[model samples]
Target: MIAPAPGISLGIDIGGTFTDLVLHDPALRRSGSLKILTTHADPVQGILEGTRRLLGEASVEPGEITRVVHATTLFTNALIERKGALTALITTAGFRDILKIGRERRYELFDLMLRPPAPLMPDALRLEVPERVKADGTVVTPLDLAALDAAADQAVAAGAEAIAILFLHSDLHPAHEEQAARRIAARHPGLSVTASHAIVREMREYERGCTASANAYVAPMAGRYLARLGAELAAMGIAGPLLLTLSNGGMTHVEEAIRAPVQLLESGPAAGALAAAYLAGAQEPRILAFDMGGTTAKLSVVEHGEPEVVFGFEAARQARFIEGSGLPIRISTVDLMEIGAGGGSIARRDAIGLLKVGPDSAGSEPGPACYGRGGLEATVTDANLLLGYLDPSRFAGGRLPLDRRAAQAAMARLAAALGITAEAAAWGIHDVVTEAMASAARTHLAERGRDASGFTLVCTGGGGPVHGYHLARKLGIRRVIVPPEAGVASALGLLTAPPRVDRVATLGRRLLAWRAAELEAAFAALEAEARGVLARGGWAEDAPAPERVVDARCVGQGAHMPVTLPPAPWPTDDAALHAMITEAFTAAYQERFRRPPPAVPIDLVHARIVLRGAARPLALPPARRGWEGPATAHQRQILSGGCSAMADIYSRPGLMPGFSARGPALVEESGSTLVIGGKGRFSVLENGNILVELDA
Candidate 1:
């Protein structure tokens, strides 16, 4: 085995259907990638196999891999499948129902049968201790140790595997929660303790409690999986640091990831967004990143070479698109909107006798009908296959042969139900999913006050390039960029990601009564905590200066907006600091709302710092091995404008830079396929990205 080299890195991303592996050797400015069906029962088995095969094919030594970056849907699946460990929550007296009583608001106001998501921890498992803290951080009723002991004992006796502590006002004063965590750990050595303050350190009992309990629920399981994977990789003669990507588009050491698995809930999608940003950051600074995998479509906005980050997001959503219809988790995550529109999204007829395509998927176990996995339901992939958008012989690099007859049978069943031809039903399924994705993109960009029409679209994932053309057209987006190795882009993104950590503290204070000394101390503490977390990865010293932002709002406002501090040194003078913050707030508010702040005092809610270690530079191959013959490999009929047309098929690598083609044309690669409409004009860029321009 060769010695470890700084230029060699490997990345693995496990999605709903596929496990993608990318081995990058920057010294050679080349990357080798592979995709295999995900092994849900033991995801590490697939990862190990994929990693070994990739290295073997490239004739590379396992010991040469300097680092391994990975992202998985394991913990996220656990939450959604309700397969996590038996968890229990302990809160302040009279607050045992906080998780159930989430703001007392219905996500669906008009629906009488609106059912919120069930709590991860049931009522029977939630127990409160004798403790009370005033909203102002003053202890009212001291914590009763005997009461805490009784609750812990009762919970353990009832078969609780993990415990969560969420005391009232713990965001402001974590003493009680910390003490309870210590006691619980000492008494129950086998149980994992997740304290709310340690998880969120912010206000809102329901959200913080949900985050803590969810973390505790998945911590033990995540720890064991990480340990097993790490041990197996080491046994494979691979000497490298193992890291996992977070929902915030940051990569952290396996230890940190195991400690807080909830932060990884949406990690798989985050990698795709990061990859899109890096691939198109220079060509198009602002873009709508569209990643369509097997089971879901993830969309995010990237501006100025960075994907936006949200302080909180919902998980295991009951209603896939509706906000607040899922477990509220307050952790930093890439700002993304996910819709149940993907290759394997099952297509069916709704109660209204109208056609609907997914929020339900066939997934890997019994993927699409075309996979010949005993799936009889019509799915997006089946539709695409029937529409000739995919080459059955070369799908998944011919590793998994597609059965056209199976897809036809599935589409025929749906077509018969809708009283339409199998071909018509296939087109309908395609358009329905596209419309769903476009509608979601419109809403997501509008919520951020962004214009989808003004942004280019960067397509990634297995299904992204196939639907991106129509999705862009629907949104009035003129330009779309398809990067190299588009199907495994998320796994590739893991290689480009840097070590990052976000630390937040709830500092509910009035900006009017600013105390520079106290605020500085708080900032110091938050930054230190963030640094310490990064230190475990041996990357703190090389990281760039951390970014500072505060969540603030008018005293009477219902929601707080995050305000980025202007580039300046830490202020010492109270008046100067106040002025600086006030100006920054007004400017940001004006930009967002087109108006100045209301005539009310501004309240600072949370202080946050994001520490980003420098990413190892990734080199895109200057060119690829293209077909020696004509670019047009063959001609296939594709549905264009709800009509059939013979589209010229081209292999992706066959098209060189400055090569231009007019559609209808299909660009096929081993990883993904791009469908260009008749009105589209496309070209290959110098870096091997296919740039598409569509006329409205």
Candidate 2:
């Protein structure tokens, strides 16, 4: 085993609102975390500033850092803002309009003017190639190399830094696409190319093409950003291997990430779900991971210690919560239901005076009105501050002080417009936003056959802990687990993720095939391909074999579910293979529909495998070693509908295992502050996780 170099490792997660950084020293078992307002104009500035501030606080030299793991929403933001490099698209002849002709479905049927997402590549940049492939992995016509070369020249002349090639049925037969790419690369020399078959070999033409196009859209941006971030870190004397978190809730080397940033689009939310799944620690646990940031709130369900894995996701939607109104990307992402309810969400009265929370946010540049950052909009944070939920003086650990006057002015305008008091207006906004989140959580859970009561709430992100208690109350959840470093939870999760690579290919085979031996050979080939990728990513030759997987469905079903198979020498016998496939399909179906499907002829749609390296076990901070800190004096606060009562403020670091602090208390850590309202109880678990149980 290669020992991690002797130095502090920094994990940075750049979110829409804040850039979180965590510095840990394995040898000393010490760590520190920081949260800085994101500098959107130049994100690298925030990274460098945060890194310098954190290292200064720890009195550690940058040269002592051995590794850096990072995750960011930059690529997603670029796609959303259409700020990526000018790119071109090449497709099979007569398919130039494929992107424009999305699977035409309106998410909102009643809307008069619904707009499907515009393609990343413009019509002028979309060129067609002369090639054709049958659905069953057969090339009907050779790729027109001369035509491809001509298109390449056009794309280059048009200033396309990146190019996406997506041909029909390429997932079944990638040889044509591969040959076209090699020839184009040899000619263009500098253009970045992404082939649908190489990135995602799924059967859907639109989805596969969309995924590869999105990857190309963000390739140049991600490459430059990562290169700059790495150089900045090294200049500061840090000598560490830098890794990036992927949407699949795993880490990959930085070099791999720059080439395929589409995989990291959901990286932030995935990390939060990982943290929840790992720390929830309940038997067959059902968890609602609520991560609220400045721009949006993410809700993901976790069951049996793993977050649900989704094969495809949409981004940059015209409607934040609408599914089909965005760019579809084929990548494995932790299934999350995200909405525009966040601290920076601007609150307003709609046409009929009905309170509306948001689909718009006051990002870090000119944050909420309370931030006194030139934002005149009344936001959720302004409302929270007006309602006395946040300490205006202590916001962001006092790095950015809040302006009560600004908050009051913003709220007063809304109050006057609604004919209500400022406090009442603030209360209304807060409750409405909470209801929005709770309702979203409930809908996501019910759709998945999950109950809120069956799960523990693990809330993180900048706004998570602040809003968690109220959300729990609304959901009738009694237990809420707020980790010590709650605000930076996503970045912390990066430190624990194992290096993994997920690969997929379409087989389109029938389960009642002519030979079971053939199925075994197919599985073996897929597994070998996965191991090869893991090896290329620096895994040792003797590393454990990868997890084998397949996407299966009934013969006539239009879609399928992914199922994992036991390591190699896969069930080769006919009856055994059938049983294995049945068990997997049944379990997955049961989880979704609450019952097994009736026995029917099933088919295999796709074969997949994920090679995961042995995860380095994390050293959890010791549970507050037997709890005696300074004597705590009780302070008073108003109860639900009653008179004021006393509560204590305890220092979490001073608390030990078996020690407990009860309600109306404040637990302050360097990274974040946790407020335990009246009638709440807090405990330090053996793993150093703080469990807060609130009165329902």
Q: List ranges where model 1 is wrong by over 4 Å.
A: 1-5
lDDT of 2 at 85: 80
lDDT of 1 by residue, 1-696 (tens): 122247688999998899999988888888899999998888999999999889998999998988888898889889988999999998888878888978887888999989888889878999989999888878889999999999999999999999999998899999998899999899989788999998889988888989998999999899899999999999999889788899999888887888888999989999999999898877787989999999889999999989999899988988877888999999999999998888889999889888999988999989999999899999999999989999999998888889999999999999989989998899999999999999999899989888998999999999999999999989999999999889999998988788889989998889977688888788889888988887777875767778889999999887999999964367799988898888889998999899898878899999998889888778767866566568766799989669999999898876778888999999998899999999999999888888999988
- Give lDDT tens digits, candidate 2, residues 582-665: 787788778766778767787888888777777655565555564446737534342221223454656567777667767676
TM-score to true structure, per model: 0.98, 0.93
In model 2, which residue pairs have backbone atoms overlapping below 3 Å?
A: 66-240, 624-656, 624-657, 627-656
Tell me the lDDT of model 1 at 441.
95
Overall local distance difference test of candidate 2: 0.80
- Compared with the true structure, all predictions reach lDDT values of 0.89, 0.80
